[model samples]
Structure formats: structure tokens, C-alpha cells
Target: MDQLETMTCSRCGGSGHFSYNQIHGTRCYGCNGTGKKYTKRGAAAAKFLSDLRSIPAEQFKVGDLILYQGISHSKFVRITSVEVSRAKDQGCYSGDGEYQQVKIQCEGGYGAYYRPGNLVRKGCGAEMKSEQLRQALAFQATLTKNGTPRKRAT
Candidate 1:
């Protein structure tokens, strides 16, 4: 039986050839110019992609507008996302990442991110009486388009 073999590198034009110079003499190899190797993607890559999609909108503030689309009375939210976070310190490397629920605030009050679509939810905004919410949305949209100044994120 016979087996097949593949080229080690395609960078050198399949010659498998490379050159080097030493204090004593010069040398050449048939494999590589530097004898280094390439590696594949790691677990970090997958985590990064997942994080990108799950952006923490809760970081936004009171006058911010978020992309919201559902059966709710309104198609968008005028208030900012609210996130409750707690710090956890083990010993050496202290870090904070975990989160719970996000809520949107309006002149009337606060509500769950998903409760706006809930039938039993009761609130001025929930009842579709969102004059303030509507104004906030419109103002924020125009401000965003005109590049109006906003508070810097802390």
C-alpha cells in the first residue's frame, strides 16, 4: 500500500525551501524560512462573536432610544435600558460581568423589557397612553440624527 503526502508550506511557492545565516556559516532548509507554525482559532473567537450579538443595551441612559419591535403599543422605546449589577471579587482577579433583567423607564414609570407585550401589564405606557414616551422617542431620534450632545457614559 502507498500513502499520499502534502506540502508543508505554500508561502515559499511549494519549494519547501528557505535560507538562514549564522555566525559560523550559512544554511538552507527545505521546509521553512523561519520554522514557525500556524495555529487555528480558539475558544475566545466563539465567545467574542456571541458577545457581539448580545450587546448590553442596559448601558444606555434615560433619554436613549433602543431598537424595539414587538406587539407592544409602541414600536420603539424612548427610555434607556437599566441593568442591575453586583461586583464579585474572588481574590486576585476581581471582575464583574453577570447581569439579570433590563427595564425601560418613562415619565409614568418603569417596566420589564418584555412586559410591554404582556396582556396583563398595567401602566400608562402599557395602556398605550404614551404621550410622553412618544415625545421622548421623537426628540431622541432627531437629536441622534442632528448629532446633538448627550451625557458621556461613565
Candidate 2:
């Protein structure tokens, strides 16, 4: 991994804190309150490293967790097979009857068929603020060329 360059947090002016008014101040979300932020190249390298571990969506199997894109605080859904016996037991497949009916459970425990596009694997390095994506990137900066992490100089 290339070195992640640091910059003074513009939102907080290197203070690690931002204030909307004299009475209100909060830690800078931009830099995670470290007063330093990553350069564009650094961020891209981190993202590229993450993108390397992802596999094609079509390869997902039973019990795999998927994160649906284009939604906020999206919960991970595990794939489970649901058998449909009759026409009334059918799931939502928004296509013509020319193809065989496929059945699968979806959000809210309803039966639905998923196209499996834009779904990210749970282990993928795609950023999730709640999941410490940046923290992992920061840790990556401390690793040696051999892929082992080195201690800070203190």
C-alpha cells in the first residue's frame, strides 16, 4: 500500500473540532477528530485495496450476507431458501411467466426474487462509517512491505 498523506482538517482548521456557533462545538467527522485528513490519492488507494477482495455478486451462496446499495443504514440480509408449493405460495418475481418461477425470502420475511446487482458482500472493504473502514485504512499505513504490521515510532 502507498503511504496515506495527511492534511490539516479544513472543516476544523487543524483543531479537530468544528463549531457552528460560539456555544456549540463538535469533533470533526471529516477526519474522525484526528485533526488530519487523507489526500485523495490516499483515500483512493484505501478504496482500491478494499475493491480487490470483492467477488462477482452472482457467486453468492446460501447463508451469505448481502448489503443492498442506495439505502441508508442498510441491514445485512442472509440468503435463505424458501420452498413454494402452490401458485398462492409464489414470491414476487417481476417478469413474464415465460421463465420458471424462482422463490426466495426477502426483507420483512416476504418472498421475493433478487437480481443480485449492486449488492456488496459483507467482507468487502466498502466503507461503512459504523464499521471502522477508515480505521482499517489507517492501520494499513503501518504495515511493512512484507504485509506484517509495524509498531508506531512513538
Candidate 3:
């Protein structure tokens, strides 16, 4: 992959300043208050990576599963709708330099806007299913009464 280009810091919004509380502000940790950040790769290169793991917005369809890049947790969501629009310039780290925006709706009724290159297709259905199964089993284990294990059927 080609080296990533320098982009604005998503955390500080390229301002080099962030609020710590209602009364105080501090330098952004993500960029050391530099107001700029480097992309892991350029937008075009990022598209290639996204394509390997996710379908591009131009090709997205209803009911397709996708991974939202802006969230902290790794969760695959079913896409319910897609919208395309123009984005405003964000200083030095602006997306694609073309300002294109893509909005997506998930099955859980949550929605967010992103650059097309930021959205990736999820490729781990089995992993997600297994995780759900594990959680279910753990919940079942917590339901035992008086510390007694459930008896097995003969």
C-alpha cells in the first residue's frame, strides 16, 4: 500500500484544542495538538482496502452488512438506506479533497455520515455469530439458582 497522506485530526477537528470539561480545554492527544493527522493511507488507497472488506457506497444495497468506521466498538450492522451528498471543507485533512459524503442507516435505527472510503464491508459473520452465542451461554450460566448446576438429562 502507498504511504498515507497527512490529514486533519478527527479528534481535535484540526484545531489542536479540545475541551476537557465545561470550564477547561487541553491539547488533543491524537495529534499532540498539531491540528493535523496522517491517514493510514491516501483516500484512493483506502478505497482499495475498503473494497477488500466492504462494498463501496456506490454499490451498497439495502440489507447489506457493513462496519461503521467511526465507532469504537466492532459491530456489523445491516444497512437499511444510503444517501450521498457533498461535504464541507475541513481544512488540511479534508476528505478526498472532493468533499463527498455518504450517509447510511443501520438495522438498529442508528445513522451516521462518512466518507465513502471510511465505510468498510464486514466479512466475519461467523465470528459475530460465535460472539453472540458466547454471550448467551454466559448469561445462562449466571441464571443458576443457589449455585447448583442444572442436571443433565439421561
Candidate 4:
């Protein structure tokens, strides 16, 4: 994934405030008072789909743990079956318009359908790697003893 460039607020010049009507403004609406903005267009969903497509359908197997994030919810489920077929009709957003679909049986016998790429193989180190990255980012946001932000992990 490419890192998004940080842009300074043009109006505030990196300051969170600007003079308006001869009064100090509370925040810069342009950057939401952060004084920095992401320069790239937010295409996270597209990136995720691309990453998922890179994994072949043959890689999935029954009894394998997988992560599925739907429009309303997310879950780690056990794969009950894998079917490779063309999509008959558009029903819901299952990550892509691809024909391949995987039938997953979650806890309590609840069944759901999804694209194979929408499911991330659990215990394949992918989940752990993302979790570690999240923790590292959170840790970096914490204040240090000197009241300064901690340096981000390399």
C-alpha cells in the first residue's frame, strides 16, 4: 500500500486557527483543525478488493478460519464450503462483481455468502500483521513521559 501524503492546510498554514471577522477562529474547517490532510483520494475499498483478488480461490479450504467484513458487520468465521461460479444476479455488495462465491457457516448455523477474496485466511499471519500494525500506531499516538508524542515504529 502506498502511504498518503500529508498536506498542510492552505488557509491556516499548518495552524489550527485563522483570523476571521477580527476574531480568532476555533479551528480550520479545511483540515478539521488538524492542520494536516491526506493528499490521496480515499480508495480504500478498491485497494482491499485488489488485495483480495490477488489470492486465488484454490487457496481457500473447508474448516479454514476466515475474516469477513460486510456492510453492517464483521466476523471471523469457519468456511463450510467453497463454490466457484459466475454470479447469476446482483443481490448485495459482496466485495466484488466476480462470479466466485464462498458459503460460510458462522456460529449457531447462520449461513452467509461472500466472494472468496472478501474472506481473509485466519491464522495465516495476515490478521496478526494487521493487529500489530494497529497496536504500533496506537502506541505511537500515546504521550511520553516528557509530554511529547512517541515516535512511530519503523
Highest lDDT model number? 3
For model 4, name the residue pairs that clash.
none
Q: Per-prediction RMSD in angstroms?
A: 22.1, 10.3, 17.6, 11.8
My TM-score estimates for the predictions, one after another, are 0.24, 0.42, 0.39, 0.35
lDDT of each: 0.38, 0.54, 0.63, 0.55
Q: Order the candidates by lDDT, highest first.
A: 3, 4, 2, 1
Ranking by TM-score: 2, 3, 4, 1
lDDT per residue for candidate 2 within 1-154, as digits (tens), equals: 3355556888888888875544445767777678997665455546544554444454556665555443345555666653332243234544453333334544556345434442344443345532455555666566654335576689
TM-score comparison, 1 vs 4, better candidate: 4
- Residue 73 local lDDT, model 3: 70
Segments in model 1 whose C-alpha atoms lie over 4 Å from true places: 1-55, 72-74, 85-99, 107-110, 114-154
Clashes of 3: 2
lDDT of 4: 0.55
What residue pairs are clashing in model 3? 8-93, 54-121
Worst 10 residues of 4 by lDDT: 40-49
| lDDT at position 133, candidate 2 | 52
lDDT of 3 at 47: 43
Report the C-alpha displacement of residue 118, candidate 3, in angstroms: 3.8
Q: Residue 58: error of model 1 in Å?
A: 2.1
Q: What TM-score would you give candidate 4 relative to the actual structure?
A: 0.35
